[model samples]
Target chain A: MIKVLFFAQIRDQLATSELRMPSSENHNIEMLLSNLKARDSHWQTVLSKTNLLVAVNQTISNENSALQSGDEVAFFPPVTGG
Target chain B: MIKVQTTDFNLQAEHDKLREKSSVGAVVTFSGLVRDINQGKEVSSLTLEHYPGMTEKSLTKIVEQAKSRWNIIDCTVIHRIGELKLSDQIVFVGIASLHRQDAFAACEFIMDYLKTEAPFWKKESTTDNESYWVDAREGDLKALNKWSK
Candidate 1:
């Protein structure tokens, strides 16, 4: 399972701490985001905007990055982080 | 030095720790607190989130960048995470230098980069059922662009 995290505005919208999703050996970052949105309308709406950025395992990432079972994916809106 | 933690830090203790030599004539520090309002809405509380291992890494990188560009004697940054109430300190940045120029520049530089590049997230609960987390400020990105070569 891949651990997914939401941050900032994304965290507020989700209203949950984290998510665990089953992944095949062949799962990718793009697929993970799409699947989450597909399952939850709130996730879909928060991620629907183009301003959101994703980070894989702490560093910023693109959508096509490969995913492993233990990887963590975080969603952010720009950097307003600190 | 950079520290990202869930524990609250004392501003005076941090300032004293970084204040070492008498040659360091100027000290510049910035403290960010959980505010009670944004855009006229009342903020009852705020929750800060971060990447477990990456937040410190990013802060170190920013502090390093400041040192490279300025002649700073000492620099320290502490950013808090987890639940917090209004007026609680959220983050702190301090820079010590031989002159005021480097101290001021480095302090502002650290804050500018921290605002746009760090991985911390805040979830604010308002008076109503609706809560909102702040979005990145466009001005912050513009400020960072000035320093990136």
Candidate 2:
């Protein structure tokens, strides 16, 4: 399974912090995002944000990054702390 | 040392610790405070959120980079989470080095990187009872760029 997490405003808007889904061959962040977007219009709207940031295995990553079983993924907004 | 905690930290203690090395001749410290006003709004309180594992990793990477670029003897970074009131201390960075220039440069370098790289978010509550997440500033991205050149 792939563990997906959300934080900050994205988490507040979605009201869902974590999710788990089965991993498949040739899976990547973009495909996972599309699967998530298919859940509902609200998910579609929030996940489609242009400024949204993603992380794979605790490192900053882009949508093209590949995923594997038991990998952790996160989605959130840009950081504002010092 | 890197610390991400909800409790307040003592500046003097951090300074003394950083200066413990006999070869250290300079210690520079930077602290960030919660402001009473932001973007024309009267802020009363602020709350911070962070990606647990990634926050530490990012900070360590930034400190490592600073060490590689400068002659740093020691460094300490402390970032506060949870709710904080106006004027409360939010973050602290201290660097020890053999000379003033290295300490000063490394201190600023860590702060600049932390502002852009660390996965931390701040939410502010205004005096009028309105609360919102603070937006990332363009100036912060610019600050990080200056170091790369």
Best by TM-score: 2
Give the C-alpha lDDT of model 1.
Answer: 0.82
After TM-score superposition, the amount by which residue A29's alpha carbon in candidate 1 deviates from its true location, in angstroms, is 2.8
Q: What's the TM for model 1?
A: 0.81
Angstrom error at residue B94, model 1: 0.4
The 10-residue segment of model 1 chain B with minimum total lDDT is B129-138
For residues A1-82, what per-residue lDDT tens digits would candidate 1 score against the true structure?
Answer: 8988886667766786688988783388788878878877777898887988888888878889999888888887776556
lDDT (C-alpha) at residue B44 in model 2? 93
lDDT of 2 by residue, A13-56 (tens): 99999989779832999999999998899999999999999999
The superposed Cα distance between candidate 1 and the true structure at residue A16, in angstroms, equals: 5.5
For this target, which candidate reaches the highest DockQ against the unseen true structure?
2
How good is model 2 by TM-score? 0.98
Candidate 1 residue-wise lDDT, B88-115, digit = tens: 9989999999989999889989998888
- Where is model 1 more than 4 Å wrong at Cα? A8-28, A35-44, A68-70, B127-130
